[model samples]
Target: MSKIWGRILWPLAGFGSFVLVWYLVAVSGVMPPGQLPRPDEVVGTLATQFRDDDLLLDVRLSVLRVLIGVAVGCSLALPVGFLLAWYTPLRQMFDPLFSFFRALPPIALIPLVIIYLGIGEQARLFILIYAAFFASVVVIYEGIASTDEIYVRAARSMGASEMELFRRVIVPLAVPQVLVAVRVAVGVCWATLVAAELIAAQRGLGASIQDAANFFQIEMVYGGVVLIGLSALVMDRLLAVVMKRAVRWQDRVGG
Candidate 1:
């Protein structure tokens, strides 16, 4: 029982302390009245918005966007990264280009995406895919490339075919890293989501925030931002559960 409470409070301790301080500061009036609202004010705003502002619909749409983005990004990136790592010649030819593309911010591609895909679901999904693809590719390629040479040699000495070697050996060894990549991809997708929705989305957390800020509705802005953050937190925890399940075969998870 004590252990259970400890586990529950362990993560909340930092956030709870921070909120306490914020509440005190907000009430103490170091900043101007409109600068930062009280914590309760923000809570009230959240409650009111959820009750009448179609916040649930916005959340559903945003979640759907993330799901689609993650699926597309993982599907394309996993194969490319695995193949590149296995085939050094291809990696050599593409690494420089890959680096260049990855270094570019996903938002930087928004203009081109708008021109090509227009300001619609495609544009938003493009941003998410662009952000997650490079992230996953880098992680997966590194994971596969760093595979132990001894294992490779042993597998090859047994006359293991390339497909067998990859499918049976490399893939299992790389599952943990791939799962980590999935986590990173999810975060990247969420981070880029707001920027994607800000462009032409009629309804989304990002759109709500943009609208709130335009009218100087600080409470509304904070509420939307908090919703985005909390949503990410929940999804990340869900991913953590998935990671635990996927890596159950390993005695200990390695980087």
Candidate 2:
């Protein structure tokens, strides 16, 4: 009971402290008026948007884009990452290219994507795919590469074939690390999402934010920002749950 209450109380306490500090800062006259809105103002804006302005719809659209981007990117990236890790020649050939691409931010490719794909869902997806792919590939590759050599040696000594070694050994070791990559890529996707929507969005939290900023609606901006953070947190938590389930056998592995 104490542990449960601790889990519940600690997060609430931290949140309450953050809000209290924010409120103090807002009332302190440090920032310009109407810029850093107080907690109440943000809540009011949230209520108004949900009641009359379709903020929930915008949030849903933004979330959908992120989901699609991460899903598609992961689908393609994991296998490629594993291949790169498993094949020395291929890893040597592609490592430099992967590094170069990873250095390029998704937003920096916006103009090229727009020119090639046009400013539509394709462009948004392109940016998201870029963000998730590059962020995840290296992590996944490294995870596979870093797997315990003892496992490989033992499997080989037992007469395990290459495919058997991979299936019985490397995959179980890499899944957790790959999921870590997914968590990081989810953050990358969310970070790039607004830029994707900025291409020409009719609906999305990013579009709502742009509209709010255009009209100097500070509270609404804060509301949109808060929603993005919350959404990212939720997605990350879901990934954590998946990771926990997928790696449940770790404790049983001796050595």
- Give the number of the best model, judged by TM-score: 2
Candidate 1, residues 64-173, lDDT tens digits: the string is 88878888898899999998999999999999999999899888888888899998788898898888898889888988899989988999999999889888899998
Model 2 C-alpha lDDT per residue in residues 115-232, reported as the tens digit of each score: 9999888888889988999999999998898788999999999999999999989988887878888898899999988898989988899899898899999899899999999999
TM-score of each prediction: 0.94, 0.95
lDDT of each: 0.87, 0.89
Clashing pairs in 1: none
Alpha-carbon deviation at 187 in model 1, angstroms = 0.7
The superposed Cα distance between candidate 1 and the true structure at residue 48, in angstroms, equals 0.6
Candidate 2, superposed: residue stretches over 4 Å from native = 251-255
* TM-score for candidate 1, residues paired by index: 0.94
